[model samples]
Structure formats: structure tokens, C-alpha cells
Target: MHRLILSLLIASLAACSHTPSVPLYRQLGGPDGIQDIVGRTLTRVAQHPTAGRTFKGVKMPFLVDSVSKYVCKVADGPCVYEGENMVRAHADLGLQGSEFDVMVSVLREELDRAGVGDAAKNELLRRLAPSRRDMVQR
Candidate 1:
């Protein structure tokens, strides 16, 4: 009986290991989830006088779509992200590292609220890593 129980436990563990990792989009609730996070992050940025000015008059729809596309692709979804590369898109923003940090904080909060897991967050970070060069004015 003990041997049988041990075999069962091993099988269970093996099954768990074989289960594929969840994608960031699915973990965060897909399109709707990313929209929610983007909205919250935008609101937080807008509420702050200093940070708000950076995105003055910038509409959220475009931003949301781009984010959703990229995240979807990164998270193993089937969408193709065809948006402009970060350097070309944001090169003129004159953003600083501090400003980027603020955005990261707000992003984390929104993701946390949306129930994105740590693994998903890490994946998002990896996907967004390249944007740093373009996002930061140096």
C-alpha cells in the first residue's frame, strides 16, 4: 500500500511538472485585463502633476491596443504585434529614468490589482526590457 501511494504521488508530481506555464495575457485576463491595467496606470500618471504632463492629450485607445498586441504575442497568444518600435515611437518623448521608474510603479500596482502572477509580471518585464533604450532619453 505504501509503495502504491508513493507511485501515485510521483505520478501527480510529474503531471504537474508537465503542465505548461500560463501566459501573461491569460493570467491577467486577456484583452480586458490589459485594458484595465492601462486605464489604471494612465489614471495614476495623469493624477500626478509632473507625470501627467508627459502624456498630455494622448489617447488611451492606441496605447491600449499596442500594449495588448505586444503582451499577447509575448504571453504566447496568437496575436501579431505590429506597432512601431519603441525607439522610433518614443524617441521624442524626452523621458528620463525617473519618469520611467514612476511608470513602472504604477504599472506594478495596476498589474497587482488585475491579479497578474509574479511569473507573468516577470515575463512582461522581459518583453518590455528592450523599450528601455528608447524610453530613456539618456
Candidate 2:
């Protein structure tokens, strides 16, 4: 009886010590998932009346790839973003507060469409929130 009790205690301890290690990137579904969210968000934002003007003359594929890499990096993934900083990138665009808000709304919708959980979606948005000050000049 004592031996059985000891074995049970040991098993319980082992179970308690096992911690799952899931990164935020994996929670957001990794590179492919990040790409999907970024692409859909950009496409939607480009169609929006308030935000579409910012996308004018931009190269879609390059912008998509760059934004994907940025999102992946922000989500704690393995990709490195090689694009310009947010401020420098948006310096010429003269973005307004409403335009930024429109993009955020579109991004939130796309994230939902991609089936990302509320926790992951909120966390990603929280991380990216600081960039608004840099992107929105007006």
C-alpha cells in the first residue's frame, strides 16, 4: 500500500512539473497564418475609402511579403522583417487617424476570418498598437 501511494505521488509530481511550451507565433498559426492575415487585411484596407489612398502606387506582392514578415516577427515567429521602420515607411503617406482606424478594423475582421482565437488576436493587436503613433501623422 505504501509503495502504491509513493508511485501515485511521484506520478502526480511529474504531471505537475510538465509545462507546455507554445509560442505566440504558433498560437497565431505560424508563418502561413500570419501571411494569410496580413494579405487579407491589406486587400481589405486597400478597398476601404478612407485607407485605400495610402496603398496607391504600392507594389502588392512586395508589400504583402514585407508586412507578413513584420507580423510574423511581431508575433514572436522566426521571420525577420527587412523593411523600413514604421515612421519612415509612412512619412510620405500623410496618414490620418481615421485611415489608421479603418486599417485596424479591417485587420481585426481578417483575423476573425482566419479563425484566430480572441486571446491571440488581442495579443497581436496589443503588440502592434504602438506602431499607430508612427504611422498616423495627421
Per lDDT, the best of the predicted structures is 2
| lDDT (Cα, tens digit) per residue for candidate 1, span 25-69 | 788777777767877787788677676666777776787778677
TM-score of each: 0.77, 0.87
Tens digits of per-residue lDDT, candidate 2, 55-122, equal 88899989999999998998889999999999999999999999988988888998888888899889
Lowest lDDT 10-residue stretch of candidate 1: 46-55
lDDT of each candidate versus the true structure? 0.77, 0.90
**In angstroms, how far off is 48's CA in candidate 1?**
2.5
Off by over 4 Å in 2: 1-19
Candidate with best TM-score:
2
